[model samples]
Target: MRFKLRPSDDAFYEFFSKAAANLVRGTELLNELALPGADVQSISERLVEVEHDSDAITHELYNKINTSFITPFDREDIYRLGSQLDDIMDHLEGVGSLLYLYGLTKLPSLPREVHEMVNVLDQQAKLTADAMPRLKSMKDLREYWVECNRLENEGDRVYRMLLVRLFSGEYDALTVLKMKEVADELEAACDAFEHVANTVETIAVKES
Candidate 1:
């Protein structure tokens, strides 16, 4: 399989980059929402806008894939990439939704691992955005996916620590349930980022 540095139609790469930017925005909003005394409603609204923008970009990508005679990568790969990117936004939005629904006045003070996990996720989103446009060349991109995988591992460790603390007679059972739901959503967002990375790696291998 031979890959070209420039595709006949560059719109796909452009859309991918746009979608990645949306993901980064979503991650940043999530980090903000995770902070103490953060305005949850405002941050959630921002995430909602990001998700809507991403959806439009994803739709444009598929439309281009359908109409274009040539593409930078396999059509299926393009579809998978768009879908996984959308999933990341969805999971991030889910985090915000949980925060609002739980009606908690503040983020939990105990078992403070969520902040670190969101930090890793934010880094992963940035790395992914940096790598998406370079897909045309498939050049020096393996490091991004590798780092995302590493971050996902780190997130898992933090998640498990939080879970253990949550169950170890910390808050009441109801509070634990609410906190666990938020934690789980954050962890799922990390996994969604890994899925995006994995899809990018697969596309690179096939194109290589």
Candidate 2:
């Protein structure tokens, strides 16, 4: 029995980069919505566009996977990457929808920190994207993946603090629920980013 190694595709890496960019852009827009008197609906529409673009990239990648005789890494890695990337886009879109659904004309006092967390998460997302193309050079890229992990951990800390603030707030039940939902969406996006980092880490290990 023989195990076969496959050559990596430049296209796959590019698609991965686009996925990362979508998440970063979506989160950046969400943070922008925090501006006083900001037009959230307009920003939400942009997020919708970002989500759609991510879907297109994922679809293209899957099509490539089907036609290729072999994948650059494990087929499971490719699948996980696609799904996790989609997860980020979906969660970001959900956050955008809530802006309209909750009719949240203004950012809650509590979510202000969460928006900051999203900014950091966006940076992490972009860093992860940068590192994806460097998967072949695992030894060199290890630091980037580590930094991404730390940034995600920062997001978790912010989430915990936000939760505390939400529950302790003087808001009505409905407002609290709305705030919680948005905060969770932000956390979910960051969690998806962590998934990307983990997937990249796994790919590094498997390929090396």
Candidate 3:
């Protein structure tokens, strides 16, 4: 067996797992939008709270990276993973805030495709949360990143369909504009999840 020398800092892994779990919370809030008579304003407020929590976790991770003489992985990879995870939360918060700000909740219901995007995000978040702890062993990660990439592709297809519906004149032009903004954020969040997976794959490769 090949031997390797590295610091035994579990804090780095703990931070990643916490950040990822926060993402799961963020996506769960987005899923709440699909409920009948959902409170968009309340969901937006909660998303802000979750986003702030993610930011705090990322800050702590960065400080830990600076202080630690050795890290679980490359220092840059840790930072990138943390930043990308925070980006996903930002996009989730954006979706909630835009829906409330544009009064889109007043519509009878959101497009089916919007919920589809949320479902994709929810899957991605759960996958990332499951994979983060696996970083400790760097084993069985291929399946995680593979599944994440597949989900990202699925999200892209759903996103394209969402745009098609938005531009099909099903609603007034103003409503379409507002919804497109929300759609962009959802798509960005999906992409951000993929970025995190890609970073994980990179770190796994390096440490192998």
Highest-scoring model, TM-score = 3
The collision pairs in model 2 are none
**Candidate with the greatest lDDT versus the true structure:** 3
The full ranking of all candidates by lDDT, starting with the best, is 3, 1, 2
Ranking by TM-score: 3, 1, 2
- Residue 147 of model 2 has an lDDT of 85
Worst window of 10 by summed lDDT in candidate 3: 1-10
**Clash list (residue pairs), candidate 3:** none
Per-candidate TM equals 0.92, 0.90, 0.98
Output the better candidate (2/3) by lDDT. 3
Candidate 2 lDDT over 55-150, as tens digits, reads 999999899888988777777788789889889889988987887678875544435676677787778777876776676545677787788788
Off by over 4 Å in 3: none
Q: Candidate 3 on 74-169: residue-level lDDT in tens?
A: 889999999999999999999989988898878998999999999999999999999999999999999999999999999999999999999998
Per-residue CA lDDT of candidate 1, range 35-98, in tens? 7788888888888888888888989888988998777778898899999998888888888888
